[model samples]
Target: MPAERQTETIDGHEVSLSKPDKVMYPDAGYTKADVVGYYRRIAPIILPHLRDRPVTRIRYPNGTGTRPFYEKNAPAGTPDWVRLATLSTPGSSKGRDTADFPVVEDTATLVWLANLAALELHTTQWMIGDDGETRRPDRLVADLDPGEHTGIEDCVEVALLLRERLASDGLTAYAKSSGKKGLHICCPISGEQSDGDVSAYAKALAKELEVERPELVTANMLKKERDGKIFIDWSQNNAAKTTVAPYSLRGLGVPTVSAPMTWDEVEAVRELRFTPDEVFERVDEGGDLWEPMLERGPKVPEVEAPKRRKRAARPRS
Candidate 1:
């Protein structure tokens, strides 16, 4: 055995590993090499979804990359299925090694990886409840965010209202924090639907809410017009737009903003009463609520014809 290899247990799984060189993987026996190995092993399962997607590096508070495990000159035997998210940094500055991984594929996968990564890293700083499962989201997620506002309570309220509306339509929806300042509400839908179809559905839903509560929601793409209301941000479903990765930490230095919650809890916390510190404490206390939610699929409504809208009167010619 290599002198650096050490023995340890993770979630009760006994394994031998080396010490981590970076602070990102702080568990005693983990290393940047181990992180790379984990990705390589899971590459076949992960790459099909990740390849070709551009990845963003998560930076430390000091504006340094939190280098995770990835190789620049991946060996020939390295499966083409595995692709590096970005370049790697060699050493640490403040006695902390850094590492980076590929950008997450989507919001759902992001959550999945975040939970798993948290477990793997043994940070105790993050937690996912026992309820979180591996089931894929049936509903599409459209994240509307105004980059400036850090008070997420308003966004949470919007998501709850939207969830209520969708439920009234017989469609089930789920919500989670983006791990930043916004909220993400995922509705169960057939992935078979085209982007245009999904976008149209989202727009209709947003318009319905706008008409009902004109004081709060705005579907306008123009920032100048959004004012204090939440933008419906249907563009998130657009092929080019990206939502925060599920488990990836964001902001200046904290772990990613997106955290999963039960629909009931989502409604309860609509007031955004909890601080990130509170969220971290709760996560440690209760664990993730998403696993169980995965078992229960959304109650999708029967397909119906799109409702027609009346055209606005044109000015006299």
Candidate 2:
């Protein structure tokens, strides 16, 4: 009988699931069953997008005692439609099993996951910014957390301004909420660029933005320094830094907040109207608005630096 599984009640629904050997789901309210059911309901929709893509699975606890998280491929005998992965925090921490979903590499897989999350959880929120033109297949995303405020409108403004500056250089960008107190701005780059190159580009962009709008944007990583401002976190582009996978569930115990949005809507929002409780409802009603953007070309510009004007020698003083 389906391996005599465990079950739990979430939002008053009985969800069936199998527990990880040593891991635990982050949210106290969600049972192992709920987690498994979540995967099952969305698996079919996600598989076609992930077929034949090279993937890297991030294990929860990622070491001895932690369960193996599979990515890129489903576990042996599992259906091809099931794109499951395991993830663990470093050193095999027990409590960290909270964030152990396998991350699929294909963009289509991610989009499907996003759609499912939006449909089931009711947390579809969109943020469009000025860098709409810079969208590309190869992307570098940095999650800029604005602690305490978590205001979607404020975050969108930051994203738009960043887009404007990047657009001048012919780069395209997009932004979304973290489903928490910050935003994620993804820049399109030539996939040809390495992590280092992406980091360089992001750092330069953040630095330039900080220079132009010091009051609003800071590239600093220190929380104390970033008080009341958005930090342009370039570190996320580093191979070691992990930004939220597009559709992956967060550790918040509730459905995550990030949602794909159209540039026009991003510019139109007075504030974030969506919430986690409403994510699934919104998806059921309608899904992502930024899907078209996924297929668009890189929009970065090619411009040469201006020559410095040599000053004529004044009278020898």
Candidates' C-alpha lDDT: 0.47, 0.48
Which stretches of candidate 1 lie above 4 Å from their native place? 1-138, 144-151, 268-288, 292-317
Give candidates' CA RMSD values in order.
11.6, 10.9
Model 2, position 228: C-alpha lDDT score: 65
Write one digit per residue (lDDT tens) for candidate 2, span 65-123. Answer: 23434332223333244344342234333445323233343333333332222122211
Name the candidate that leads on TM-score: 2
**Candidate 1 minimal-lDDT segment of 10 residues:** 119-128
Q: In candidate 1, what are the lDDT values of residues 89-200, reduced to their tens digit?
A: 3453323233333433333332223222322211100111233211222346756564344245667668878888877876677666665456777765654444555666
User: What ranges in model 2 sit over 4 Å off?
Assistant: 1-16, 19-28, 43-137, 147-151, 268-277, 290-296, 299-317
**Position 225, candidate 2: lDDT:** 71
Candidate 2 local Cα displacement, residue 81, angstroms: 11
